[model samples]
Target: MNYALFIARKIYNGGDNTQKVSKPAINIATIGVAIGLAVMIISVCVVLGFKHSIRDKIVGFGSHITVANFLTLQSSEQYPIVINDSLTKELKTIPGVKHIQRYAYTQGILKTNSDFLGVVLKGVGPDFDSTFIHNNMVEGVIPRFSDTENQQNIVISKTIADKLKLKVGQRLFAYFINKQNVRTRKFTIAGIYSTNMKQFDAQVCFTDLYTAKKLNGWEADQYSGAEILVNDFLQLDPISYDVLSKVKNKVDHYGETYSSENIIEQNPQIFSWLDLMDMNVWIILALMIAVAGVTMISGLLIIILERTQMIGILKALGSRNKQIRHIFLWFATFIIGRGLIIGNIIGFGIIFLQKWTGLIKLDPQTYYVSTVPVEINISLIVALNLATLLICVLVLIAPSYLISHIHPAKSMHYE
Candidate 1:
């Protein structure tokens, strides 16, 4: 083992007899590996970052899951339901439940002197976790509902504020229409936020739950729905089913029955699009690995040809075939490791630069985000490197077998 390792070191360091001619092929293989790995790292980080960004925005607009009256189906958000203490407690007991907040909404239009835009007046109680949306706030602060009275403050999106020429602390009239009459209320702009989720941003504004209930003529205990948050979003499907099973056929105070809807189900198209990115990422990974592997194979064959006389000398000295193979395999391992180090440095440097500087820009109207996003998952990075190393080592196996077939007498005499 020590002799084999010594031979590997000499070959890897270009200190062996074949060093001068094999150097270029080895360098080419290393460069190929570096480029392939860098592409893979960027692809994974960007795809996961995009998925996380979009999913968080959707969940921020509507939590991971919703429990509401059966009438508050996926297509519409107009129905009303009252929260039952027992049902809420039961939901809290369910595994993975992170937060439960009361929400109410009614259709309304915000009017300015020259322009008016329609929006859904979404109201949240004190239980709402403002942290998710707070990060996306471009101006002002998220409002906390007061228990003493109905808060007249509302949070509107930048899109809404821009269209209506509204600003923080500005007052506007929002008119809610019902079957019998249209009720109008004056509201103060508490904050402005931008998720760049055009559809939700254009149609929704945040306010106190009491205000939404009052606008809809609902009683003190009533809400349109309860937004449910969970700890692990990837576990959302099973959690949604668990929530549905627990809340299904359950009745609210006004004899309304309840059901649960998860964010993925409610926004299928967005999630489906996100899923498609997985296939894209896999294809990229496969192609890159193939390129790197092919390059390494070519480099290995070149190294073998250049060192044919060395192999004959080693075999003539009674060195076994397996030992000769280990030398080349170890050499290949060093090349791959070097490439990984360089690739990681360059790839992570680019990722960090983009993260801090926002160098890459995207169209918010199309992608729901303004800048290219990236996430550095350490486990993923480690796995990628390990898998690449393993695959490259395995691919180098067949090529190394050429050592065993080399005859000492013929190779040594072949010019």
Candidate 2:
């Protein structure tokens, strides 16, 4: 008979005594392992969700790299916002340069009869990339500047619409200062959109480049500034640095500061809050694993003690010490492996249920995009399983040591 198989079979049935003291501890061990595996899988999926979601949203609004002049929107004086065809061609050749755009923005008020809404008005030239924004738009078009040529067509947001009781083709008065520094004419609301972002949905509006220039009384060729988009977002810092090398005197508007005065730099509280939560998740995982390891260790120890006679019997029958160790290890391995499989299935099922049904709810204002997002990284799952299996198998070493100490004559007669 294969001792490993026989020992495993014995252990599986050994915990059947209902009133036995050892049975409770063995039960706790299984529960601990199940809980640990579940927690690890869920934690990994959630964190991965957060990292990917935030990164996509940010990089969507602002490209990987941004370039601008020292003075911004209202303060900047006498500049060329347009990327001359020559500069555009040269910039396109730069590595990681996916698309380049010239964009201008101004803060203005939208008056609808009795109500007035303060909004940041953005204008983009024909070369502007709308792919990202267009795909994310929940309603309305990106506004075609081709036919009207700045003829009072603007896109407003849903929040602004609700506040102002405005809609497409309804004229909403937008007032701003012209280049001549005089109060400008009001623009007409031609279309409306919602980007699913509260901050932008409520306070931002858009039109084409010619429209902003016409309202500002500037030359047909002028603009406020340009926005550069990159191929990949990971190289954001490096690309920002390289572009700034050419325009050393220029200040970036989108994500402009390398200084402590910058909003992100000054108010680190947001990122700190996320990092703290991340730490908590990690700590929770570590504690769960420790709980599992301790409980499993206890169970193994109990098995080793109860089977002292059997280990000695196997040895007296000319069995190798290593074989005696394997006898118990086979049992432990089967137990842990079964728990791992079941735990993963249960955890993944819960995640899928929550994802499909949205059984879990969160405040949209706090979580940004609403609903809990989940991301599954297959590689991460594989790595976690491998680590757990290795660590648990190594831990069996301590329990297996019991075999060498079991002398045949002494253990067989002791009981």
Candidate 3:
């Protein structure tokens, strides 16, 4: 049986009243740790939540990656590329590839009685993933696509619809600017969606791929580009390279020569803004850890002072300095454990509450999300707990050494 652990538990449980320190000081330290941990947890939730929310909006507007002819560099222009069965099969085989869909965009203007808006008419094939659009649809239904029959349905953003005074089932005229002259088509408003991204929402309108092909004067087998979705956004770089290499290898037979562009590389400015959040998170984490460390240090010092008489008694009994240190360290560990447990409960409680109720509101213009978002990563929580425990224990060790300096005669006689 380990006597140090046994004695430490006894003191912690207050079964041995003589070994105890002032309750108030220990309570204050524990509260300090709880507050620090709570702040850290909330900060982590907001930062990661904001990062992912912005990323999903961008990906929804574009895609995780784009496979297109090298000439189709800008969103406004398109050079038709055929994504044949062989090319699709090869792309699917690449690890982490989620969904592939044909997409094409043309520059156009929407004209209503009251107003007009310059919009990019983005054409999507039947296989288009509409999950993001459905989630963010403020009103009406997504434009339905039929392979055999032409569907002239269009999905516009509330930002555009409101400005143009357009409504669902309303027939509007969209004029496309071509090199030769101008082309006009009648389109029905099928839906209104809002991604809360002002720039993307203002500039884009969705329609069927057939309409885009007809507008571009392309054949049935051709598409401006293929949008590729990946299972993991973090693995974009490797997956993009793998996809590019696979496409290159198949180009000999399939005649599917294409270049891949990662979502990050495509919109460098917005991603750069997201990257800045990491620095802010790191700074918050360091500050919280420092605060917790200082609180633990103060608590350990008090515990030592309160037990100076016991330290002397133990020393006189021939207890080694290391063994006595273990006793105090164990006591400090108990205090930290209590703080962490209570802190986790309080912190997670707030997180869950906000997640369910959305009690916190954010400015959509500034944050790109109406509600304050949160993400609870189990691995991150575990790492945080371990790091805090380890750092606090290490910090207490320096103060624990003061036990060795308490001379047996001086401590015993004075107290």
Candidate 4:
């Protein structure tokens, strides 16, 4: 906008407010806009932060991708799992690949004291990623590879341990149904770990790969599918595609094309629920931006109304209409930009505070965590900034158009 026109617009918008709208009204309007913007921005950041944080937890516990046996049975019976270890070794060379471990998990019953619970007994080799539960261990130790024959040791979840009143070095009997559907063998309690997700922690128990092999009666070379731990969880889609190129000689589950997914796909419903939350966050974000933009538009219109007479004088004094629009544009945009900055400050401040202090609480029984998790998506914030700014500019078109219709002759001669 032209500098002179902009100044003219501002003066006209102000309209000698001293004699018209009292300073109190202007203050209220400014404060109202500030509050609305702050609320919207903060709401968006908080909700999105929670969604992203939960996803990272899921990824850290499980990898970005897994290669497991396809569900071929329709009778609701467990299927036999086997993977091509040669193909797994070849797939590990793909870029962004980190580590691959063969795993076999089966539903088993563990008996400890007065309690009996079902758990996913994971049979893993020495190469398993210990970091997943390294920090999450709240009691006992992690599942150590048994060094002796007939070791019969296992790691249980904290939830299970508490319910059963069992501790480390206690004997826990595990019952596994073989391919023949016969109960065979028992595992001892060597360690206990918790991921804090009761849904997961309560059900996941761990043991060595050799034990799973003995139970399944598979040959030395046969085992269940592989869990592919990646350098980054976000690389799942791209790496999964590359995986198809390498694992063609092996089993193909998706239309004869090996797309990544494993026996661990049992938790699809939980993940689907998580994805729903992601969509909810985005929808809330869109609504917030709209609410903030709408409130600012109302403020600008109020400012425009109070300046009608000044707009007339400027128009009569030979100032072009386009220049007149700039003054109001600058005023409204400046206010919005200021509010945006303030909102971001408060939003991120709250996130850090909650992260350190855990001031916000949620019911772990219902929410899976004791406090809200905050994970800022920088790209999301940037997109929100641009989007809100653009909406403000576009909505400004309405009241600003009122500039062209201002009749200076009648205004200077009349009120």
lDDT, candidate 2, equals 0.67
Model 4 Cα lDDT, one tens digit per residue, 139-246? 677756631234577878778888888888777677777559766566667777765676677788778877877676665555556777667656766887787556
Candidate lDDT (C-alpha), each? 0.89, 0.67, 0.85, 0.67
**Ranking of predictions according to TM-score:** 1, 3, 4, 2
**TM-scores for all candidates?**
0.96, 0.80, 0.95, 0.83
Candidate 2 backbone collisions, by pair = 68-251, 69-251, 70-251, 179-216
lDDT score of model 3? 0.85
Predicted structure with the largest lDDT when compared to the true one? 1
TM-score, prediction 1: 0.96
> Is 2 or 4 the stronger prediction by TM-score?
4
- lDDT pick, better of 2 and 3: 3
Comparison by TM-score, 1 against 2, better one: 1
What is the alpha-carbon lDDT of model 4 when measured against the actual structure? 0.67
Q: Compared with the true structure, what per-residue lDDT tens digits does model 1 show for residues 272-313?
A: 999999999999999999999999999999988888888899
Best by TM-score: 1
Question: In candidate 4, how many Å is residue 392 off?
Answer: 1.1
lDDT of 2 at 25: 57
Error of 1 at 284 (Å): 0.7
Error in Å for residue 165 of model 2: 2.6
Selected candidate, larger TM-score, 3 vs 4: 3
Give candidate 2 misplaced runs (Cα > 4 Å). 1-28, 73-82, 145-148, 185-191, 216-222, 249-277, 320-322, 413-415
For model 3, residues 317-374, the per-residue Cα lDDT tens digits are: 9998899999989988888888988889998999999999999999998889999999
